[model samples]
Target: STWDSQGEFYESEGISKESVKLALKGSKMREELFDHYYAEGGEEAVSDDEMVKYLDDNYLRYKSISFAKTKASTDSSSSATDSSTDSADAANEEAKAKRDEFLEKAQGVSFDDFDSIIDEYNDYVASKKASDSSSAADSNSSASDSSTTSDDTSSVAESDTSSTASDDTSSVSDSTADSSTAASDTDSSADSSSSAPDPYANEKMMNYGTMDDSQKDTANGKILKEVSGMSTDVATAYEDDNAYYILIKGDVKDRDTEYAKDNHEDLLKEMKSDEFQKKLTSWVEKLDIKVNNKAIKRYTPKVVYDKQTEYYSKNNNS
Candidate 1:
């Protein structure tokens, strides 16, 4: 009702009479009020830098109320936890005293004799396991005898049925023989059909250079892209996982000698096998295989890619 007269100013400034009253209570309250104003202002709010400057100027006494509240909360929580811990410790001490008194009353009590007690328990456990195993074996033996008897009865019945079936089979054999001749005729036809010419027969001798415009596709039917040194004479064949090439040597169609000469300007200056081996050895010698001792020890053997062969022989072989 009071806000109706000053409603326009209150709405624009985002400060009602109730809010102003609360804010005037203390500097902390005023800062809280400013926070609410900033949040609600939206488009009417001042720029962030201007807001910060204004807050700095006006709220000089607003000494981080959030920090104070947080510190108070942490202190109270710690105190409560410490009190609970103290009570629990007292309870535990009382329980321990009662246990010690009970133990003192018992005669010939030796805590050090636990090892012997454990050994006896283990022996009992082993005896129980052995007893269970023996019972299971006896049960299995009885089951096996019962199964054998059933199998024998079934076998006798099967023999009688088989004898009857054998008579029927004799009759069927004559008809089967006629069908076998028909199947043999079908097999002959299939064999003749299989003798059809191989589609890839032309591709075996066909090299890239000798291939016509229409036949310039790869073995898998991909379009042939021209490369300067890749000649037609080199017969490419693939089998298993390996690519085999037959290098044809001739006067004009000499792929090996001419291609090498044309493609490589310094073909004569190529590295020899011994020289390459020496270079490889020198490069390998320069390599620093930094084996981190801590790192190697941290991981399990299974996790490591390069496991020692002896580990498998020792552990898995057993």
Candidate 2:
């Protein structure tokens, strides 16, 4: 109501109340959807369309998939088997081979089996995290017992500097930071958040359209875009800085018509811009035209202004 009484002020400010209303309306919509989702059984009862729309609106839901790398003993599996440089090269190749094998396995996974796979994947991740954490604590205990650097699984320290190659809702990373002889890292009471094993480190849960425009131009983003276009039935392969990925896109809903209508003012401005000047001039020249200069001069300025407002109000809605 205040806006109605202060039309000139709004015109001068150039702020669209419709856009503000839409932004604020998001919270209410989320609350309603939460109620709606639970009213139906959380998973089985939710329709395909409902899931698609929820994801399209950027909710943190995803199809959880496993990504445990298979260990096949290679000829130079250990550094002692060869020279230092050669051994390191062999280890890298072995890791790549294992990662590629998992990617291949992931590509064959059907969308229907995704729901069934979640429990197994979750259990594996939870166990791996527990084991890594136990190993770290034991290493720290031994180091403290006998004043020495804890050279146990550097996985505890590695997680600290892991690359953020995952867009999973759980936010695990895939980097392997080198363990240093620094005594500070040997503390059994190191920050739990830093030492905790990343949830998606050994699993691959695929998310969609999570990257910004800048990321889309990168090799990572380009590959993700390619996966987004594929059907959910078939998985697609990609990789980032520290990890390989096998992702399949989720179902998506069409763009909202109501949302598009929010940009009608922009559309109107573009149509009236200088780029259309020649076409507009041609339309005016070809169309029937009339002048009422002498008759118009009889009406007051306020009456002419009211008429102009009425004309725009009718045309704008159309």
On lDDT, the leading prediction is 2
Q: What range of 10 consecutive residues in model 2 has the weakest lDDT sum? A: 176-185
For candidate 2, the lDDT comes to 0.43
Worst 10 residues of 1 by lDDT: 62-71
Q: How good is model 2 by TM-score?
A: 0.35
Cα displacement (angstroms), candidate 2, residue 30, comes to 22
Per-candidate local distance difference test:
0.31, 0.43
Candidate 2 C-alpha lDDT tens digits along 1-318: 545754444443343667446655875764454434333453324343544443355312123332322222355647544554564445445545644554565565665444334444345456655676777777766656775465643332422111111224222231221111011112223335796743323222223244457655655445445655667656555444444445544443332232223323232222223334564577779989998887667556776666567656755752
* lDDT (Cα) of model 1: 0.31
lDDT of 1 by residue, 136-233 (tens): 66766666667745555321111111101122110111111211111111112223457674321111111233234444343211112222123332
Those runs of model 1 whose alpha carbons end farther than 4 Å from true positions after fitting are: 1-109, 148-318
Residue 125 error, candidate 1, Å = 1.0
Give the runs in model 2 whose Cα sits over 4 Å from its true position: 1-108, 148-215, 218-220, 253-318
The candidate maximizing TM-score is 2
